[model samples]
Target: MPELPEAETIARALAGILPGRVIRSVTVLREDVVAGSAPQFGAALRGKRFSEVGRRGKNVVLVLEDATRVVVNLGMTGRLVPGPGPGVPPASTHPAVLFHLDGGACVAYDDVRRFGRLRQLSRAEWTRWSRQLGPEPLSRSFTGRRMRGILSGSRAPVRSLLLDQRRIAGTGNIYAVEALWSARIHPRAPSNQIGDAGAVRLHRALRRVLRAAVGAGGTTLRNYRAPNGNEGLFQRRLHAYGREGRPCHRCRTPIERVVFGGRSAFFCPRCQPC
Candidate 1:
């Protein structure tokens, strides 16, 4: 699954090319991808101009001229591709939706697993849906003090707490392991067990890893790709996410893997102190 940085990368890329383009028509290849009634999806979006493309957590929000927003959650194996011309081949694997733009550009949403979703909402109603997310780690509101406050009362493992969307948005299992490894913190360490200094280290580590991942175009552990269909390079730069039994970069200790919440978490036993 693409996390915050991946979603943000896609949003930024779409923002560059989507705004000012008018939607001439919309094709729904799979009905399940449309969150509401098919008539509602077509009626709300067909002739609207795209005003903006932005991201809220892992979801992409496309603002239209009529103040209607198209929200997309690109679940695992999902890809949003923008084509050069109208006759470009449709995404055959799992092409769910296609938007024909007045500018001759076409954007297709594809998800091999058919788990991604698309929904149209009025701008006024989007706030209600967005309220469930916590602060963005890269935003001004996610300060060290704020993170410390959130972790101070939690008894959950630090990695588990970081993965909670209600506490901090955009982090998933992959980045949680990477961030904890970068901070030299164990995955199973209690959140409250981390000292003030440790909290500061974690806050910085999270931001650093996320920013770096975004720069590298996000980790391509599975089917993640940029708008141009290029795989991310961050996976090559990962320290411990999927390198189980590999030697640690900083120390000679071998990285270990364990199951947490049914997901595999990789860490260096010696470097990540409990």
Candidate 2:
């Protein structure tokens, strides 16, 4: 589950390798892995030079010389890495698509579950889709007051609200669980009932955890790694996520797990009281 931190790490890695590299050819290994006609997708990107690489929420943004934006939503188990060449075996694993660059370097897109998608969009299309997502949590505009407003009208569980991309972008299950735990808030607490102080605490915790994770190259629980094939070190510093039976670092209370909305949330029962 590559959340904002994972996506940010990938975008940073790509930024170092992709920009100014001209695409000589594109090979789509799995037709279903991409949106629309895979052939057309490849043709559109061929001969285009990468102008920039960045992230919007949890998606990786690739800006091309022609102003076409290639957005990759690495749903669940997707990865993008720069490799040697198409003829050479990938350093990490086989790829779904390969973008052969001018100097024999290549960029590979790999997704084990095939849930991720690669889409080519015009500037107008990118702007429209981006507007539909909530504010980037790491942005300066996403203040505690803004977070309170987002939760004030919702009756959904706080954890669910955190996972809602339309309500708060870039947070998936892992970061949501960690943020809630860090704030000492119960996952089942009603969003509208969290009050202003609690919202501020949650907001601060979210930003802290996300920044720390990004600095550490994101968490690599499984099937996640930087483009350089280095696993994230943040997973070792996690406080609550995936620590159901483990002791809480802050409190000696055993961490607990609960399932709702088809996802599991981990927390410390005593520290995050209902």
Candidate 3:
């Protein structure tokens, strides 16, 4: 799935090319991908100019001239590609929505597994959708105090707490494992068991790993790619995730993989002691 960094990268790239361009028309190739009525989505967006692009959690928001917004959650394999000309070939193997722009450019929303969604919403509606999200990890609002508060009473594993979007937006399994490993904290450690000092360390580690991953254009373990269709470079810097049996960078201990909540977590047994 395209996590925070991947979604943010796509939003930044789209903001550069999509803003100020008017939507000539919208085509819903896969009806299911359009969360609302296809006709309603098109009617609300046709001829409206895109003013800006932003991301909340793992979703992308396209702010339109009319103050209405288009939200896209690229669940798993969704890809948005900007094309050169009118009637350009679809970018994804299975495109869900295609936006024809007045400038002769096109933005294609493709999802291989048909799990992604596209919805048109008003500003109030957008607020409702975003209200449940926790503080952005990259934002100043996510302080150590806030982290300590969120994890203070939870019996859930620290890894599970990190993955909760309502507590810390934008972290997924990949970054959670990486950050926990970097902090030398075992994934299975109960959240409440982590002291304030430990929470601070985990908070710093989360910020560090996320910032580094964003700088590297996000990790491309599966279908994740930059808007320009390039793979991310952060995978090369991975220390624990997906490095099962490989020597740990800090302790040279063999990395191990364990499944928690049916999700694979990688860690160094020696470095990230339970």
User: What total of clashing residue pairs does each candidate reach?
Assistant: 0, 0, 0
CA shift of 206, model 3, Å: 0.6
Badly placed stretches (over 4 Å) of model 2 are 85-89
How do the residues 1-274 of candidate 2 rate in per-residue lDDT, one tens digit apiece?
Answer: 7899999999998998889999999999988888899999999988999999999899999999888999999988899977755456456464788888887887789888888999999889999998989999999999999999999989999999998889988999989999999999999999999999999999999999999999999999889988888999999989999998999999889999999999999999899998
Find the candidate with the highest lDDT and give its number.
2
lDDT winner between candidates 2 and 3 = 2
Ranking by lDDT: 2, 3, 1
TM-scores for every predicted model: 0.96, 0.97, 0.97
lDDT of 3 by residue, 1-274 (tens): 8899899889999989988999999988889989879988887898999999999988888999878989899998998988855666645667789898985778899889989999898989888888888899999988999889888979999999888998888999999999999888999999998999989999999999999988999989888877788998899999998999999999899999999887999999998899
Measured over all alpha carbons after superposition, the RMSD of each candidate to the real structure, in angstroms, is: 1.4, 1.4, 1.2
Clashing pairs in 2: none
Per-residue error for 139 in candidate 1, Å, reads 0.7
lDDT score, residue 212, model 1?
Answer: 97
Worst 10 residues of 3 by lDDT: 84-93
| TM-score of model 1 (CA atoms) | 0.96
lDDT (0 to 1) per candidate: 0.87, 0.91, 0.89
